[model samples]
Target: MSSSAPWKQLLLNSINSNSHLKHSTYFQLATVRSNGRPSNRTVVFRGFQDGTDKIQINSDSRSCKIEDLKHCPFAEVCWYFTETWEQFRIHGRVDLIDASNSDPYKLEQREAAWFAGSVRSRLQYLGPTPGLPSLDEQPSHDSLDSSAGPVDVFCLLLLDPEQVDYLNLKSNERLAFTTARSVNAYEYIKVK
Candidate 1:
């Protein structure tokens, strides 16, 4: 519940230091399925929510990840920076903001995320749901809007970190940044 997550600075530094790599923005998100199984997928990092440490990611409401989150909001984001030889395991709870969401601020974030997306990215959402064969499901060029604005299926996934386990392979150092929820603060513990 801390506004400024202690690990945010380290993550931002890792991102800035390795900005040249395109895959730096990608991370593996692992969620719990309804059947108590773990589902993992690679997702792009949209950015942190405005002025907050919450991680933001664009999602499709129809996506299995959404269903997974509904079953359990908890997830872990695993990010590795090849250039820096560092890895971060962010344990958190995700907040979903879609058309059905009633929160105004979250809805605003969703709208902003939609408009921030490229036309091509926006258009993809109009196609058939993920994992489905799309030959007939494909929308004609003329049938798709270039803007393709935010659809009900387009959702914003925000992750509020509960703990961040950061590892530096080069230095052989590991640290755990855990939230002290009762005090709205974070405790930094060096791990072996």
Candidate 2:
């Protein structure tokens, strides 16, 4: 275990650096399942808001992890830097971004880009629409044409980080610091 001061400085420095987070692809998201067991999965961090500490994660709200959040709001996220051997642990409360909870303009813009990427990632790689059915497979219901255009059902996971833990594998030490909204104002504590 190590003192929190140095780790907090490292955290602030890393988060502020564009290159540190820019190319990072995956983060570990941990949520308590309905059965009260801990469940974790790898998810991509779309972006994080600077002043608010709000992070946006692109995920299907219908996912098991999302459902777990609905049952239990607490979540823990971990990100490891393979090159630098530094790891960041984030403890936060997770919430689903519904129409009422999210900003319309921001959500819509991100959603449009998300839908486009979703379609391109899945359909474009497959070449063309196969002989199964066109986008509007069900005329009675809304069009299933995700390839044709964007949809609104998709949502972004909002993370309100409360505490952060930092670990330097090279130094063989760990430090824990918390935010104001957490129990204390960034106290340096050793975790053994």
Best by TM-score: 1
Q: Mind giving the per-residue lDDT tens digits that candidate 2 earns over 1-192? A: 332333445755655553555445467889999999999877766555433456677554445776798899888989887656778998888767643445776666455545545443323223232222112222232224565543333556778777878888888888777666444345657884
Model 2 spans > 4 angstroms off: 1-23, 99-150, 182-185, 188-192
lDDT of 1 by residue, 54-153 (tens): 8988887888889999999999999999999999999999999989888888788899998877655666566675533111223435344655558778
Count of clashes, each model: 0, 0
| TM-score, predicted candidate 2 vs. hidden true structure | 0.65
Q: Which candidate is the best by lDDT?
A: 1
lDDT, model 1: 0.84
TM-score of 1: 0.90
